[model samples]
Target: MFNKLDLSKELTGRRALVTGGTRGIGAAIAQRLLDAGAKVVVAARTRSDDTPAAATFVAGDVSTSEGVEAVATQALAALGGLDILVNNAGGGRAFLEGSWTIPDKAWHDSFALNLFAAIRLTNAVLPALRASKAAAVVNISSAAATMPFGPFAHYGAAKAALEYYSRTLAMELAPSGIRVNVVSPGVISTPGSDEFARTTPGFSTDDWTRNIPLGRLGATEDIAEVVALLVSGRGKFLTGANYRVDGGMTAR
Candidate 1:
């Protein structure tokens, strides 16, 4: 069993960078790392009031090549070097009409944010990751990847690609002592999701929760805690694995 109290300094002396770390799930991950005693730098297109105060903030969009380069450069500069990386930035709007209605731009944007960003940022930071004796990378995916739904086809497809990429990356980096893993969250309650719920016609949180074995939506901290464990010494042996923190929703 994992004990939160015992993990206060589990990541002491570690330096971390979390993409999309300004709010929601990304913000929670950054805060968890900071609480675990790691020097954290968060990268996003803009800083918000919710950005963690203790974490250094770098402004850059992960969805573009130029933005990826800028974020990687600035985050490394702020943290000096990186021991951990959490690719926690990803989202997409539901195309209620049908898959046919999802525009080319939507597909392109989805892939850019959910798949390419992680790949590009990792490549950019490969050198720093190689230098760390205990480096770990966690890519945030969505349960939608495996449980495909019509409205979320593009987002799901992109996340599915991310999972495939993460597995390949883990194998390639293993010999170099860099661990790579994926975390897929199910129906997480965040500001983004709340907005999605409000705007999405006929979308009901209660209906969604009924399908969850845990009988509730997941909190950002729920995902963050799992990520913290994966990057800590306790999970040194774990890599190339996908952890579904979805309150057992995927089990069914």
Candidate 2:
């Protein structure tokens, strides 16, 4: 049996689900967990040719009722029951002028995708989570929730809500041996982020690095490492926390 001093196998025999796990930060998180010895299930609306081979793929959208149902059913069946759930399926659509020019549908869609999907998926898996001896739920938020740059205002707003909801989930689920937390990543250099940086007015990849205290853009693995820790036995005492893996972006 492994003990706390053993870093090599903290999550052995665990079963996990990661939404949007086919690409970007989500893919990195899925890979990290697999490395930690967890049985991983990756959920996405579509399959990618580059999707990690170690994970079992469950194609479905997490933003809709039917999609959520599909992912939940598939995950439960595949994993038997889930010991970890990562809500990583949310992102932004570039709409210039943000709050000033964005349409109602954009705001609603943002909430549906970023906030409500987590809520629905979490609710769907609660029973299984309760049954587990040790369980965790990690919701992927953004630095924008606190930093609040306007171009992705709706995304930020939705993520802010998710952070709040995640804390409450922690409080309610703690008694049942389930820990819920939030991971807010800053400007990571993913394909989607690279393009967003290049096109979003004054922002550029170089400029973003200059502003960050780390003097570099973050990699998807940077965020993944933190998530891997949070879902493992090392995080047994942690719950209701919003972890910012932002390279000190918010410290300034």
Candidate 3:
């Protein structure tokens, strides 16, 4: 069934960037894109203290304007031009607090990390993305954006903003041939997720798997494969769309 959509080698000669690429979904996407023949640059505030062999790492936080500038400068220097940009760098654990208990600073901080980071990075690299034939932006959103669990309201709100922003950018950039899209994933199993699993009350592995119609917690590859398709030529005509990798979570 999948053979008809081969799309193999569709990413050859392309240059890709994956923010928060040191681990989890970002790392998986970076590896897969490289396997498909795209040169990749992985960026985050810290290098994996563990994976020394991970993709060429560029150390820069996306929370500040200066950090954003550093990432953009390093990326352009490494790739000469940018083709596919995957904004995949972010995570938050504070969810039990009500909106009244949530500080204004925390809410704004979440937006900085989850929403504004992608916006600043995209803005800085617009020129390079504009210069490429396959220029595209892939914002990694969350199923929570729609689900909006009470504890993680701020995180969900930011992701929701990301989804809307990506859609808006798609229309504005469509005339310029720059495609912008979003990938909304359900919970995926990763090292970053392990702590969430252990700490988040009642969030057992079994619970997560059972909640999904597919009956399994997603592997990083599960999300990575879809991302590859979107950034590749196979998804050339796709823009302003949210491709959900959630295991029927949002569908429910």
CA lDDT of each candidate?
Answer: 0.94, 0.90, 0.86
lDDT of 1 by residue, 1-252 (tens): 566446888899999999999999999999999999999999999999889999999989899999999999998888889999999989998999888899999999999999999999999999999999899999999999999788889999999999999999999999999999999999999998988877788797888899999999999999999999999998989999999999999999
Candidate 3's residue-wise lDDT over 106-160, tens digit each? 8888899999999999999999999998788999999889985777788899999
lDDT of 1 at 100: 89
Query: Using Cα atoms with residue i matched to residue i, what is each candidate's TM-score against the true structure?
Result: 0.97, 0.96, 0.94
Q: Rank the candidates by lDDT, best first.
A: 1, 2, 3
lDDT of 2 by residue, 1-252 (tens): 345365546778899999999999999999888887889999998878657899999988888989999999999999999899999998978676657888899899999999999999999998999888889999999999997667789989999999999999899888888999899998899988898877778779988898799999899999999998898877889999999998899889
TM-score of 3: 0.94
Task: Evaluate model 3: give its lDDT.
Answer: 0.86
Model 3: per-residue Cα lDDT at residue 13: 87
Off by over 4 Å in 1: 1-5
Report the candidate with higher TM-score, 1 versus 3.
Answer: 1
Clash tally for model 3: 1
Best by TM-score: 1
